[model samples]
Target: MHSRAVFMLLAAFALGACRGPKSDCEGSYESWTGSMAAHDWDSAYELLTPEFKKKVGSPKRMAAYMEDSWKGSKSFEFSPFDIAETNAGVCTARGEMRYTVKIRGELPKDHEQVYFSYVFRQEKDGLWYIELPGNERIQSF
Candidate 1:
């Protein structure tokens, strides 16, 4: 009976810890998406890993890429359609985004919508960050 009670207690703790971390991760991703949707480049870039920031070289270059890919936009939003996580701190997220943008006029138009999937890994700081495949092969400058 004592052993069974101990097992139950350990199981409860494990479950609780798992639940808490998952929720926090979800919240973090949500915040990340929100910042990106608003084109808050600084805020979104702040959430990126040091390696990612370094790879992009500077905020100016990063902004240029982001703007080119997402320019003249009125609004952008992401809805997480799926998420998968493994015990090794590797995670994958799939989502769809809607963006409203203007090509050259004052009135914005919904021109691009895409479904994206991202792979992330937890850093030493225990924060999840995006890691792209073949990122090393791509030179920033």
Candidate 2:
């Protein structure tokens, strides 16, 4: 009876800790965007895949390239993602997001809507990292 109770306790802990891939990815993506909205480039950069950072160059360069994109972005939010998962466990989540940016010399309370695709890859440790995003080099502005 004691062993069964211990097993139940362990199972409960495990289940509680596992938020599932979609939830985890959503949290990570939201956190990344939150950092970008706050203009914490390095913090946002850290959430990207290693390969993306390599392709985009250092964090400073990436920030420089994206500065304009974020500079006028007063606020932003994305809709629910349509997540696609492969048998190998790779997932790509895409959604349309609205941005409030400075268009031209004026800062608008609302701007155009854009699309962002979050490419997710599971590492050996079974943790997923966002491999790419439409806001990044993968898609056009």
Candidate 3:
């Protein structure tokens, strides 16, 4: 109940504090995180940029990777984010992400806050999508 309240407040703050492209980025990002938190890999995969999907190969592979990657994850919420648009269609958001991770046979770790900087690209369709690093090895993306 407490976590849900916090999530609601964060969602309100994230959705309420913007206009224009940044708003779109925030919305897309919120959707992405929400899907991931719900373990809706199919929806999350659909939000990734085509380029990212190509790099990751099929949705099945992406799901497999995310399944392993998110094994200990509980919930996640974004802090205030700032977007910088360098190129016409590219932008980057810098902020903190708070989440929980539970290790097997251990007490759940809660409210782990970490700084995050992520790239976003607005496709020709005028929708923002996640863009991972060019190198596939980086976990940050």
Best by lDDT: 3
lDDT of 1 by residue, 1-141 (tens): 999999999986563333221234565466466656666565556556567878888767766777786677767777788777744666667788888877774766775557877665566878776554345222212
Rank list by lDDT? 3, 2, 1
lDDT of 3 at 42: 65
Error of 2 at 58 (Å): 1.5
Task: Please write out the lDDT profile of model 2 over residues 54-112, one tens digit for every residue.
Answer: 77788798678668667778677767567666435466667877878676876476755
Judged by lDDT against the true structure, how good is candidate 3? 0.69
Which should have the higher TM-score, number 2 or number 3? 3
Clashing pairs in 1: none
Per-model CA lDDT versus the true structure = 0.63, 0.63, 0.69
Runs of candidate 2 with Cα error greater than 4 angstroms are: 1-23, 103-109, 134-141
* Local accuracy of candidate 3 as per-residue lDDT tens digits, 17-111: 32112237767767666766666676667777877888788879878888898888877777756866756666667888788889989999876
Better of 1 and 2 by TM-score: 1
TM-score on alpha carbons, each prediction = 0.66, 0.64, 0.70
Best by TM-score: 3
